[model samples]
Target: MELQQLRYVVAVAETNSFTRAAERCLVVQSALSHQVARLEQELGTRLFERTSRRVRLTPAGAAFLPAARQCLEAAERAAAEVAAAVGEVRGRLAVGLIPTVAAVDIPGALRAFRGRYPQVRIGLRVGPSDELTEQVREGTVDVAFLGLPATARPQGVVARELGRDPLVAVVAPGHPLAGEPVVELGRLAAEVFVDLPAGTAGRLQSDQAFAAAGLRREVAFEVTTADSLMARLVGEGLAVALLPSRYAPRLAGVTTVAVADAPERVEYAVWSRDGRTPAATAFLTAVGIDPEAGEARPAPPQEPPSV
Candidate 1:
């Protein structure tokens, strides 16, 4: 019936508990219940059924939840668009970065963005590429930097190539293959591999590559962080891991090799594929480096070399 009423209903539908939804909505439990009752009365259907142990959405509530969310989101975006016109990109801009991208460029990119936009609140979250894509689709992030595969992309996400970060195999210094002059994925099929958890974009790519080569792969160990992966690779000599080339330069005493037949992992700028906003436009321009612009912009003058 009203925006507040819609919000109350949506919140209750999401949390499935009036008390919990009240906490999320920052209102008292009694007030939330009253509002939801009013909403149900208007809709001619009960949104939630209460029980001693738990709460569940009724059939009517399940059907109306998405529309409620859409209404709120559209109103929020509309207000944000108007705010953007005044030359201020004010609002919390949530950004999602894949682990590899976060490792290499997030700091630099954040520095650049913050220097230009001190007023805009910036929020950063890092995860694997697949998770990052899901966040973008859910509107959990305003922009994302991820290793999205070029084949199939998530719906409603506009991906612009930021750059390609090559994936290299990392081996411990004392390992048998560490000093090899030639490195190939085919040979490493039997060697243990340290992989990010399943469903990660990087792991997905790695798996697909192995599949293409007609090989079955196994993970010797799984690590969630780059540092942990590097430590495992360097200290145990237990398995070889593939990560962005940027991380390769930082891990000392590890043998990094280029995968000859593997596809180069690509990093891209992902945003809501709909609507234009100054913040989004400015961000895209700041990060976009055309891979084929034909003309190289003149470099900034460097200090003369020390005599």
Candidate 2:
């Protein structure tokens, strides 16, 4: 079967409407439908069940869909590789990161990457560290930025350590502990707190620290975004939160206290172990990382301009 036929089939399967699929494929409805029909006939089975009301994938279609997608991806990667050999980078860059990443300025990095490789399409996903790590391992994400407890490392992927910082206590300006220069985990445990969901990498750092100290803090609020909802909770004097020291300074309306015995969180940049796309490598370079060495590269010194 032709690659164009496979593309038509995939588009129809994803959109679930022949007309919409044709629009997406930049072809007329009849041409797209005819190609899909030809593909099905060649395979001697109907791929989709078509009714005037709705369109659904048949059993055969479901079985064929995944392999079809793989083929399309392989074809795209081959083309990208061919272009890369000539010192051209053109592909999609899928980036995933936790909300609290601090080692690199993500927006600025992306802006530089876009200026350098304008042909590459960029997509970003914000998620928890664990989920982003998994996406990197699964090849769905080209690269990811993660923050995990110092005791843990990203598994089954190529990773480079970005930085590490101790957790700090965030409290409202008028809260009792707000004025403290440094606080112990035990003391923070005695107060109500706002934190990330249990078992998430962000939450686990504080949880493990408290458990090690033989203390339990009541989490009055469990939120996903620390800079937004969790900060709001702490700012309103409802509860306190434990966040990475580097990130805490960015939160307004809250006071950050040093945690004398707080758990440390490590930030890492991870990518697939199998290989990296040229676009992914270009992005890592833009951020001053060496993808092959898994380490930060020294910035090039500026040269004096000729008069």
lDDT of each: 0.70, 0.88
TM-score of model number 2:
0.92
- C-alpha lDDT (0 to 100) for residue 197 of candidate 1: 72
Runs in model 2 lying further than 4 Å from the true structure: 297-307
lDDT of 1 at 178: 66
Model 1 lDDT per residue over 200-300, tens place: 66677788777888988778787776675555565478788776665555666577766666556776767765544455555544554332241223223
lDDT (C-alpha) at residue 46 in model 1: 84
In order of appearance, the predictions have TM-scores of: 0.76, 0.92
Tens digits of lDDT, candidate 2, 77-145: 898999999999997899999999987788999999999899998999999999998889878899999
Global lDDT of model 2: 0.88
